[model samples]
Target: MAAGGPPPVLGVDACRGGWVGVLLALGRPSVALFAPRAAELVARAGAAAAALTVVGIDIPVGLSAGGPRQADLLAARELGARRSSVFRTPSRAALEAPTHAEANARSRAAGGEGVSAQAYALRTKVLEVDAWLRDRTAGPRVVEVHPELSYAVLTGAPARHPKRTWAGSEERRAALRAAGIELAGDLGEAGERAGPDDVLDAAVAAWSAARVATGAARSLPDPPEELEDGVLAAIWA
Candidate 1:
């Protein structure tokens, strides 16, 4: 750790075990392939994670825009993202990146359909998940992820996995891999996408947490309760 620097974030690809990757910003490339469920990821880390600061997730923490209702409008206003806009189901670009066709299939299995009968299942779930973490902690900067931007932040260019979109399978996985996902093992399976997305998003959120901790990415938007705590911990940890 650098002097006067917060602890490094654990950037997780949130994929399957085979592709379940973990990268800690403790310096040096500490990437790996150990797939763990989200609850397990937290419980397993136990005191260690509690001791740290942030968690970024690649999953949607809020619901998607279903037509244009009040909540949808409010959410869009809050994130500053429009309904069905580029950030629409922001995870789309993450999942459809362009490497693993398998991840898209698996992500669908995780309940995120490529389309919709009502609202986007995954997006709805993001709202639930976001609420879940918000309800649980007084610490850890927990936030939704937009991997296209995440890759941009990490690599300073559109370099992650070939820049994909939810429009198709080929593009999604490519982008997921570029974001550091694996195509065969843990990330390749169906049951793992939930935890994988959560973990990776947590990682990115953690990175943002790091920036805030360093007093570098100084931007603020009256976030939900406890979210700021998570971000600060992720950065300081």
Candidate 2:
């Protein structure tokens, strides 16, 4: 770490190809990389990984078996109109189901609502993080973060446009700039593969990760409920 500077932090977001990660150190984007797997991305952080103080990822972490997680409920309430951006996580049983139909059925049986195809689609990634955390490789530093919430906190309101839209992209970038993190020039191969929204989401996630590392971030459901296995069922932003 630089003299009197904040420890390194990482922000990661899932993309079409794999995952896009942005490493922030000394209050700036030090490097960006795209990895086919989450662990690979952390490894690519190299020396930064050793002292990585926190990692904020745009994915569900701790899961619930009986119903929707309180973190998800609180995050939705916080987003207001943008609440749709926050997908209610399916029960752990649903996530482990064999097929989408079965998953939906399991979710409805547990939570009183069927799982959406969109939310169900995240099962693989959600399970991946769950396993990774269980192994304790990146467990201690990893925290679930919703990019929309990070942006909402940054701009004092939920974003006014959809993330995939041009206007929305600009809105997110502007928020990052206002927070003193600039995304300019060439982003190398990773930036080329990941969508504009993915990159921006990673950047803001990194901003939140930095906040988390420095003890400046807040968690939804403030106290953060813990799963039976000790994983936190909360979203920090």
Specify the highest-TM-score model's number.
2
| Global fold similarity of model 1 (TM-score) | 0.46
Error of 2 at 158 (Å): 1.0
Segments of candidate 1 deviating more than 4 angstroms: 1-4, 12-36, 46-50, 64-87, 90-128, 160-206, 218-237
lDDT of each residue in 3-37, candidate 1, tens digit only: 44466444433443322324344433323334334
CA shift at 3, candidate 1, in angstroms? 6.1
Distance (Å) between predicted and true CA of 101, model 1? 24
Per-residue lDDT of model 2, residues 1-237, tens digit only: 244556888899999868998888774455778888887787777455567778899999888877778899999999999999999888888989989999988877875478888888888988987877777644338888999999998889999999999999988988887777777668897879898899899989988898898898999888999876577778999
How many clashes show up in model 2? 0
Q: Any idea what lDDT model 2 has?
A: 0.84
